[model samples]
Target chain A: MMETIGIWVAAFLTLSMFSFLYKDNPFYKFAEHLFVGASMGYFIPYTFFNVFIPYAYNPLFLRHNYWLIIPFVIGLGYWFRFSNNLGWLSRYPIAFSMGIVGMGVPMSIHAQILVQMRTMMLPLTNINLILIFIGTVSILLYFFFSKAHEGLYGKFTSVGIWFMMVGFGASFGYTVMARLSLLIGRLQFLLGDWLGLIK
Target chain B: MNFSDYIQKIDRRYIFIILAIAVILPLLFPLGLPTFTTPPVLSLYKHIDEAAGTDDRAVFMDFAQSPSTLPELYPMDLAILRHCFLRDIKVLTISYYPQGAAIMQMAISEVKEDFPDVKQDVDYCNFGFRNFALRVPITLGMGDNIAEAVETNAAGRRLENLPIMEKLKNYDNIQVCMEISGAAPGIIYINYARARYGVDVAIGVTAVSAADNYPYLQTGQLVGLLGGLKGAAEYEELVETFANNDIPYSEKKAQNLSWRNQQYELSKVPYKFKQARIGMDAQAVAHVLIIIFIIIGNIGYFIEKRQDKNKYVK
Candidate 1:
């Protein structure tokens, strides 16, 4: 009986969301607010119990990890943003985070940039490899703002534009598929899971 | 306005209705449109098939997907879990997002319903959700001691007490770490886990982020990828095929059949399990509708242009 009631509530919300296709209405707004409120309601407790208690409280108190106290103090600095007198103190935590991220940037570059460049440097023995090399070079050339895109360079940049367009088109097509999949999920829930209209 | 203008300026509500019909009709009566596996997905399947069961090598699943992405990502999660259970592959599951813990739990429960004899904490364990800020340290720590890195399961039970962690100590026992997320954590895993510990990484990402991971796949950072609903559908096909060949229908598939497909033949998969494929049907129909509309709109546009040109000439 609880499951049935849950299904009805879900079906109502699903239709409420779908109602936007006609025009904006109170149902859609209610569903939107409910979703946000429900998410927050779920998030706060889960974070407190699962994240804060385990990662913070357990380590500081149970483990007697005195070193953690430093980071704990730094984390507390974030709360200072609420104090008009000490609002500037929040920058310490922000700066600390930025510094840590700065140290991590090189690692990201190593994986995302350096490694990618190395892969692109492979011997172009095959036609597919040759095309890839060409596409890569031309696309890079297209973004070289200092150089004038004219004559032969212009043709290369134009080819790069085509490559970009093709990439965008593929991405767009997949985006459509993704959106439709979400709709299909909702429809399945309403029709099959809720109404038993589908086998 | 002429027919062309009318077609050009057709009410969007009409299109919405058509799309609704396209989606609904397929659900009611599945067309069973065929799905093909891509190279990235096949690469992932092949890696798991070859490396999973040997030397205590387990698959570490990072459940980073949010609820909004469940429709697209959940099927892939379910399919992977089903595959792991069927192959007797030791699995360790974790979630980064808070909501992901619930989704992972649901997937585990649904998949567990099939393998009754399979023991939890021994065969599979869920590490649950962690703070995003701790992602790097936790991943790096897993390189040394998984039990130490992840102290407890989602339920606050000690990880060392879990039977699966007895043999599985760290990255050495982990064959491939599959990170499924709407927002791809491929880079994070690649930078920390793979670069630091040599752990093989795979990604199951939403289609929007799928293209971004291609460079990683090409560079050998990611072993395999399942992108979006299509990827999920493809993976499902792989699982179904693998099950049909290896496990007899009566022994494995029959018992695990979803409630919706109880009346169907042993060969026929349940609708609940076949979500990705069923979704693909709606996808195909919707694509066709979009294409038809695009053509009609373009035709109207060209006609309008030609008529305007004639008026200027006159």
Candidate 2:
């Protein structure tokens, strides 16, 4: 009985959201505002209690560890938003985060980005690999600047563009598939799990 | 008004309405379609299996998805949690989004029914959400006391008093850290946790972010990758293959109870990833529809371009 009630509430909220499709009406507005208020109300406290206090403070004072306060102060610097004179205090933490993240960006790029590019460039030694290699080189040459449209380079480059277009088209197709899958998941819940219309 | 101008000015509501029907109709009547698993997702499952075989292994689940992408992430999260719990692996879930915490709690409870004997703090814990994604790990890693950061587990208990992790020093004891996350927190895990610590990382991310993680996978940094529901469904299939063949408890327990006994019994629960499989089917139909739309759009473009060319030629 409780599960049924909860399901109905979820279904109603979902419908309220969908009401925006017809027009930007009151129902959609109300739902959107309610969601915003509720989310912010929940998030601020959650972050403080779960992550801030125990992970930050407990080890610092309880364990007699002064070093822990470094992050604590860095985190507290974010509250400088409330201060006019000391508002610049927040930048220190932001700068620290950026610096650390900056360092990581190159590492990740080297390991993840460069390696992936190399893999796509090389390809496995197979029939598909041979085809991909030929296509890639031709595509590269298509942009070659020494001749006019009366030559093979111009035509080959056009072919390369077509290949790139098809690849991009496939990627877009996959994205559509993923989004559709999500929509199906929610609808399935409404019907199969909630309404028991479909087993 | 001109015909071309009128067609171009079709109401925006019409697009939304079409999208609604397109989404709704598929749900009411599913078209079962085949799905093929990619190599990265397969590797992820194998890595998870290998990790679980080790001692006191823990997987940190970050549930940070929102309503817009709910359909995709929920199924995948449930599958990974169930797989971890069934093996008596320590599972710790932290939510970066407030609403996501509730969702994670609800999913964990539902999945826990399959493993009745699993304790709250001992085998599983919910650290809930704390602000500042970078701060949580930085503080925890610094102090060697993560429980001190959060006041209570998801069930609302004093973290210091929790029976679980009373013996552990820090996250060093954890063998793996798997994140079923959305965009922002996924980057957090990669940047802070994976880079700083030597923790084996696996990611179950939304489909949009899947390609982004491919670079990480190619580098052999991420052991496993679950991209949206399809990846979840694949993992389910892989786990289920082994879940069923485990030794039965009744006849075997009469002889002696071993460490594997707890896990064998947990595996008795059904191993179907119903949601992800269903979502995959819907996805197949949606892709076909979108492809049709794209072709139509291109045809319209070509027709306009050709007409312009003819006018100039004359």
Worst 10 residues of 1 chain A by lDDT: A96-105
Model 1 CA lDDT for position B88: 76
* Total residue pair clashes for candidate 1: 0
lDDT of 1 at B298: 90
How do the residues B166-244 of candidate 1 rate in per-residue lDDT, one tens digit apiece? 8889999898999999885577889888887888999998887887677788889999999889999888877776653
Q: Clashing residue pairs in candidate 2, if any?
A: A47-B130, A47-B131, A54-B148, A54-B149, A55-B148, A55-B149, A142-A157, B44-B224
Give TM per candidate: 0.93, 0.75
Task: Please tell me which predicted candidate would have the highest lDDT against the true structure.
Answer: 1
Top candidate by TM-score: 1
Which residue segments of model 1 deviate by more than 4 Å?
A65-70, B51-55, B244-266
Worst 10 residues of 1 chain B by lDDT: B248-257
Write one digit per residue (lDDT tens) for candidate 2, span B166-279: 654456756556777766435555555555565666788777667556546655568778877778776664454443343221323222324334443455533235567656
Scored by lDDT, model 2 comes in at 0.65
Q: What lDDT does each candidate get?
A: 0.83, 0.65
Clashing pairs in 1: none
